[model samples]
Structures are given as C-alpha cells and as structure tokens.
Target: MYGVFPYNNVMATTVSRTSQKTARIDIRLTSEQRELIERAAALTGSTLTQWTAQQLMEAAQRDIETRARLALESEAFDAFQAALEEPLPDEAQQLLARSPQWA
Candidate 1:
C-alpha cells in the first residue's frame, strides 16, 4: 500500500541551469481582473501565458522603483519649499560631521 505524496517530482524541482532566469509566484485575482488580462493578451497577439509573464515583470520593475529611497545634496534639497521652512546644516558642514574613522 502506497500513500500519496502531497508534491510530486515537479514540486521538488529547482531553478534551471540555463542562462535564462525565471521565477514562480502564486496569485489570486477576481474573475473580472482575470478576464481583463485574457482580453489584453488576445489583443497583443500573445498567448495568455506570455502576456501574463510580461505584465508581471513590468509590474515588479515599477514596484521596485516606487518603493526605493532617494538622497539629494543639501543645496539641491534646500530649494524645495519644505526645506526652506526648516533650518538645515550647510552642505559643506555635513561632510565634517562624518566619523574620521570611517575613512
């Protein structure tokens, strides 16, 4: 008597050794949203699979950029209205505050 395994050979698979990179993710979407994706994929002359892959890649890139933090020089930052209202150290003075040991 053999008991069934939850996952088969496919579930234990790892990334391919080829140059192409790939990832797998799980998602749940409303029927309406699913239909929208199918329609867009048809319009673009791509199979639903290819279209979904491209869209997810683009979305991941946008999310990465939007969530990243940015830094700017003091004078450049000072030109903003909020910076004008708040007192800030001079750009040159900021360099002096660093730990000498860091060098």
Candidate 2:
C-alpha cells in the first residue's frame, strides 16, 4: 500500500504537446473493443482517433506517475520510513490473523 512518491527527476520541459499530424500508429483491437471505443468516442463528441489518443495519453500519464520514485530530504525520509514501519492497528492485525482460518 506504500505509494512511491516522485523523485527529483523530470523529463524535458516541452513547451507544449505536439499537435501536428506528423506521425502515425496503428493498433489492432477486437470487434467488441473497437465498438466500445466507438461508443465512448461518440459520447465525448470526438472522432475515434482523437478519443483513442486522449485515452492513451491519460493511461500513459497514470502509468508513469505510479512508477515514480520518492526523493525526500533526510529528515523527511526518516519520518516517512518511520511511518511505514509502524505496526498495523490491532483490528487489522486481528483480521489478518483470522484470514487463514477462512481458507
């Protein structure tokens, strides 16, 4: 359940996302998937390509964010590690202790 907070690393600061139609990528999807995407695109009033691109960008952002690592000051690091190492609450410990019996 620990969140890997971001470190001080950053990608190049691009002034803006490219908007020119300068590249092409092809993706294959099952009929059902394509239908679902089409429906979603219709709902958002965007073309299939536009909707797909937006969805891809959003997913990529989430993926990168999750993989980010924490870079904390020494004091902050000590505090964070201290918090993580604290014991689970009694009720949670009790529930975990009983989990094996459920199986």
Candidate 3:
C-alpha cells in the first residue's frame, strides 16, 4: 500500500512549538523520508516546523530575486543599451504624428 504513492523528501511542518497553532498540513511519506527530515532537524538544532519555514522562505526569496533581474553578459548589455539609444523607425514616427493628441 505504501509503495503506491510517490515520496520526494521529508517535509513535515505541522508540529510547532505552541499548541495554539493556526494552521495544519497533512502529508504522507515513507520511512526513509521521515528519517531524512529528522536528521536535518537535528543538524540545525531546530524543530520540524522551524526548519521547513526557514527553508521555504529562503527558496521563495531566491526565486523572487532571480526573476527580478536579467543576467546578461557585458556585450549583451552594451547591445541592449545601443538599441534603446537608437531613434524609432521613420514609419513609426510618421504613424505617431498622425495619431490624435490628448489634452
């Protein structure tokens, strides 16, 4: 029955320090997964809840920062700047001139 589901890693995050916890999450895992999580918790001297929260936050922040900026080589950046510096094409400028102006 246990072999029927897929297990990635130990990610137990429900057991917090306080009894008045506001949220709960239920998940299934194999013995190997459980042991791995416990070992990680022990190494960090943090409970399951703390370790999961910290790791989740770190990953999310990293993802956000990665997306916020484009990584380009120096040559690519120079080309991009050059493109911006160039004027719009003659047809595009003519079309803009014909469009109605707003007050």
Candidate 4:
C-alpha cells in the first residue's frame, strides 16, 4: 500500500499496490506554503509525501463524487418529471421523423 499513514491517532487505509510500478508528480510551492503543509503533515504523523498524496486522493474522490450526483427538491423533481412526460411540439416531432444527417 502506498501513502498509508496514521491521522489523528487513527490508521488510514488505502488500496494495496499489486506491482512495484510507480509514477511521480512534482510541484513548486513557496516556502510559506511548504511550511504550512509540513506542519499539517507533522500533526498527522505522516511524512510530507504521504500526507500530500493522501490529501490529493481524498480531494479527487470528493470532486468526482460531487460531479457524479444530481439533487433536486421535491417540487423541482415533479416539474422535471412532468416535462419529460409531455409530448414533443409538432416542429420537434417533425425533426425527429427525419433521418439523422450524421447517420
């Protein structure tokens, strides 16, 4: 497993690495930024690399999950459902009847 560490006295888990293959990513940061990150890593009892990777992975997962979901209030959902059930306008129906140009 890569980038696993103890945070707040609790162990963090990650997927097991099945092979020795690895890749590297590099970034430049100001000294102030580095210090802040180093301080956070120290508090979590993780090395800078482990802490940075863990945070990046968690943030990436959160972003992906957010993008994958849709939420609507009950009234809004009902309106959306009604719109889908409504028949297409004559112009739209005529368009649908034609063979697609791309096809």
Candidate 5:
C-alpha cells in the first residue's frame, strides 16, 4: 500500500549549506503524507524535517521564477508608459463643471 506513492529521491537530501539559510515555520499536513516523508527520509538517510525543507525550498524557487517576474517586453513597456502619460478624465472635469456647488 505504501509503495503506491512516487517520489524523487535524487532531490531528497542534497542540501547546500554554503548558499542556504534557515527559517522556522509552522504548518499542518496529513498523517499519510507525514508518514511518507518519514519513510523517504529513512530510505535516503535524512531526517524527515530536512527532506520536507528541501522540497519546500525547491518548490519556492520554482514558484518565484514562474510567477514573480515583471514580464513586459520593451514594446509593451513603452505602450504602458505612453498610456500613463496621456491626459485623464476630461469628461469628469466637465461633469464637475456642470454640477451645482452648495455654499
């Protein structure tokens, strides 16, 4: 039953102390997943906690690279700047001119 889940053992315990830093966080996971990490850790000669950290770090890096880029090309950037530079709300100014002001 335990053999049903798949894992990438190559990334299991390959930690780099030189370029890495530590942070403490609190999270919750299912017992089955926890058990799986424990088993993987044992098989890979790593602590369950360390394996989880490595997986998190790799996932975070991937997510940041994929989601966090300011990704406009040069033509789009120029167009966006031009749009911002253009005048705004001439109709709003006309409406304000027409509206009655109470003294």
Candidate 6:
C-alpha cells in the first residue's frame, strides 16, 4: 500500500539515542500527504517521525501560550486598572460585615 513514495533518499540527522517511549499515537493520512511530509523530512535531514514530533510540539506550545495570555489595548487596560482601584459599594460593605454561618 505504501509503494508510490520513494523512501531511499531520507536520512537520519541525529545520532542513535534511546529513550523510554511508552505512549502510542495512530493517525491516518492520504498517500499524497505522506509523500509531501516525507519529502520535507528528507530535505531537513530529519527522520519523518522526528520532524513530525517536533512540528507537533511547536504547534501545541504556540496554541497553549496563545490561550494562556490575556491581551488588552492601552485604553481598556487603563479602565480595568481604574475599576480595581474603586471601593466596594455600600451594600457590598454591609455584606462583608456579617459573620459567616457555617453548617
């Protein structure tokens, strides 16, 4: 089933190393997609597995960092800071004066 792509030109860039790899991930792709990735890997002197793993890791890190950050414009940031500096309303102050009723 994997006959169409030429695999002879790909080379492993890194020296032989061993690690405890206990997890497995399975994915399905079209032959064209596989061939494209294989070509890219060969050009970068990386094994297909290594190139794919690195790409996945970089993409995941970017996604996580983007989600974790809160970006605000300068005017909005000033408004937010001003709100924090304001005192609580009278009703809120009264609520804080009461003792907690624990069951």
Give lDDT tens digits, candidate 5, residues 1-103. Answer: 3453334443443544344666678778899987988999889888977888888889999999999988899999999999998876899678877858763
Which digits, one per residue and each the tens of the lDDT, describe model 3 over residues 1-103? Answer: 3543233222222233334568766778899987898789889999987887788789999999999989889999999999999999999899888957762
Model 2 worst lDDT window (10 residues): 8-17
Cα deviation of 37 in candidate 6 (Å)? 0.8
Error of 6 at 58 (Å): 0.4
Model 3 Cα shift for residue 70 (angstroms): 0.2
The lDDT of each candidate is 0.78, 0.84, 0.79, 0.88, 0.79, 0.84
lDDT of 6 at 52: 92
Instruction: For candidate 5, list the clashing residue pairs, or say none.
Output: none
Candidate order by TM-score, highest to lowest?
6, 4, 3, 2, 1, 5
* Residue pairs whose backbone atoms clash in candidate 4: none
Candidate 2, 1-103: lDDT as tens digits = 7654344122222323444477889989999999999999999999999999999999999988877956799999999999999999999888887858547
Deviating ranges (above 4 Å) for candidate 4: 1-23
Between the candidate structures 1 and 6, which one is better when assessed by TM-score? Answer: 6
Per-residue alpha-carbon lDDT of model 4 for 8-88, expressed as tens digits? 225223333343338888999999999999999999999999999999999999999999889899999999999999999
**TM-score (all chains, Cα) for each model:** 0.45, 0.51, 0.58, 0.64, 0.45, 0.68
> How close to the true structure is residue 48 of candidate 1, measured as C-alpha lDDT?
84
- True-vs-predicted CA distance for residue 33, candidate 2, Å: 0.6
- TM-score (C-alpha, index-matched) for candidate 3: 0.58
Each candidate structure's count of clashing pairs: 0, 0, 0, 0, 0, 0
Identify the runs in model 1 with alpha carbons over 4 angstroms from their true place: 1-22, 71-103
| Candidate 2 similarity to native, TM-score | 0.51
Which predicted model would earn the best lDDT? 4
